[model samples]
Target: MPAGGAAAGLVAGAATFVLMPFERVMPPLADGLPDRALWPSVILVAVLAATVFVAVWRTGEPAQGFVALLCAGAVGCAVIAALGDAAWLLFPDRMPDIVPLNAGPPPVRHALSRMEAQDAYVAAIVWGGLLVAVLAAVIRPVTRRRTAALRTLTFAFAALTSVAAAAGGKSEAVLAALAAIVCGMLTPATAARAGLPDRPASTAAGD
Candidate 1:
């Protein structure tokens, strides 16, 4: 549990730190309309936090599932930021105000649209979707099933990578990469836990 706690703290702290840069990229609030442009990213982080708690509480393998999800989310943000513009036309009005659809030169409009899409991807789908799956994985714990944890992380990365590529750079590749790192840390912990000796309460206490 202590190891799981450490993993959770590390991933959450890292995610919060990473999200700080977003303040500069966010859209301005208008008449307190809630700034729909920023809601996705916010939702992503919130979901991640919830997923971390769920993963640790259930599988006792916080390092693998929760941390991997965090890494995937970061990669997702980067991918979306870099490649999202290529497919911006598909979701024309998904995020207003940030797209610059009617307020900029052709290249500038395209760039803004991409930037906005990337931001949304990072905040909403990449982070949000992964977090949701992580929670599902947590709910389905595998105390001695290392493969289940690995499979969860693998599926998340694969799905996000595919989505990012489909969106043509507005993807969550950065988040996916980060998730791989977390998965690496988690896998070993899962394997170790599977081999841990189970002792009776009295015997362990006497030792």
Candidate 2:
């Protein structure tokens, strides 16, 4: 699990670097940047889900883990959709002028307007927080020494998601919050089965 977490972190970090310039040049909320930028994260989530499913299946906890994975996927998708909706609703007047996803690079002189830029910033913060929460939840079991910290962080991310939902009126934020909570709970269970010291419960449960 440690190895897996390291690998995922490396990959995600690399991807972020590669995308940084593009993100700077293009508003994250503009065009398909939000969708396109999220592809790597989605892939990571899928891979982690599959890994957890297989691990749980091997340990005879297939049903629970599988359900968790499905819920995670649904929640993640809902979050993405809600974020997109929020971006659109953030500035209704600018919706028509917003660059289309396939319109090629926006003219250099035509950068995101002030309101659009603000929305883009908010989108980045929200999505980035979600990604961190997802990764932390997925890798918490293998984190050793830091499991408690990670768990706290995951809950904090969920709280932030809830706040975002309220401010943005994005229902998906609620789903994402629920998903984070579920993942936090499931991590310890799955880790206990896998013989990882995810938390005190694993030791106390005598698994």
Candidate 3:
């Protein structure tokens, strides 16, 4: 049996300090929902973040796994944002909006100005970390039943994002989502291995 429930403070503290810029890219609720709706989302995100922390701690080398997943998530976000930049160049009208879609065709989305691109880069880092913190938490590698259930959860999230991105006509986001999928599937195992001391006789295992 494994001791659990202790990582909540650690994860919450990390999310607070390290994820400060996350609010900038988040969807505004004022258009439809009341401002109070934000609290539920905030609470949900905290629970999800805690779930992810526990999952990673279980599936990988404890401290190292969590850090590795964080690093991998950051890199994945960077790559996705870079891909988004490329997509912006190719299709000036198709850049993503984190908001819900309206009923009609949207107005033209312009190419990123130099200053806007800088802000986008910062947002990317935050979104990447936040996304992995919650969404990728579903993965519990090494155990078949848990892995399948979690993989299903991860893929469901991936599907929702993919559909949303496609609906928004953000092909770059759709492509970037593939990186997220990879992160969910592999980061724990990769990080766990990196943390382990090599031995000739036995393979390092996870659950």
Off by over 4 Å in 2: 1-53, 67-145, 168-207
Clashes of each: 26, 0, 0
Top lDDT: which candidate number?
A: 1
Residues 1-207 of candidate 1: C-alpha lDDT, one tens digit per residue: 324433444444434334443323543332134554365456556656666666666767656455545444533443444333433556555434455467688667756655654554444434533543443344333334554556577566746755774675533554563454355335445543443564444444332
Q: Each candidate's lDDT (Cα)?
A: 0.48, 0.47, 0.44
**Cα lDDT of model 2 by residue, 1-207, tens digit:** 333333333343344433443223444432355566677656665666565555466557654454344334433433443444454466545443444555445542134332343443335434544644654555424434345554675668577685866687444555455455445544443443354444555454343
Compute the lDDT of residue 93 as modeled in candidate 2.
52
lDDT of 3: 0.44
lDDT of 3 by residue, 1-207 (tens): 011222332343333323333223534332344554465457536654665566576665454345444544544455535543554567655344543345234442222232243355444534553454453453333333344444555456455555555465344454445445444544344322333444332343333
Q: What lDDT does model 1 reach?
A: 0.48
* Window of ten residues with lowest summed lDDT in model 1: 22-31
- CA deviation > 4 Å runs, candidate 3: 1-31, 56-65, 68-109, 112-118, 121-123, 126-207
Q: Which parts of model 1 are misplaced by more than 4 Å?
A: 1-42, 91-207
Sorted on lDDT, best first, the list reads 1, 2, 3
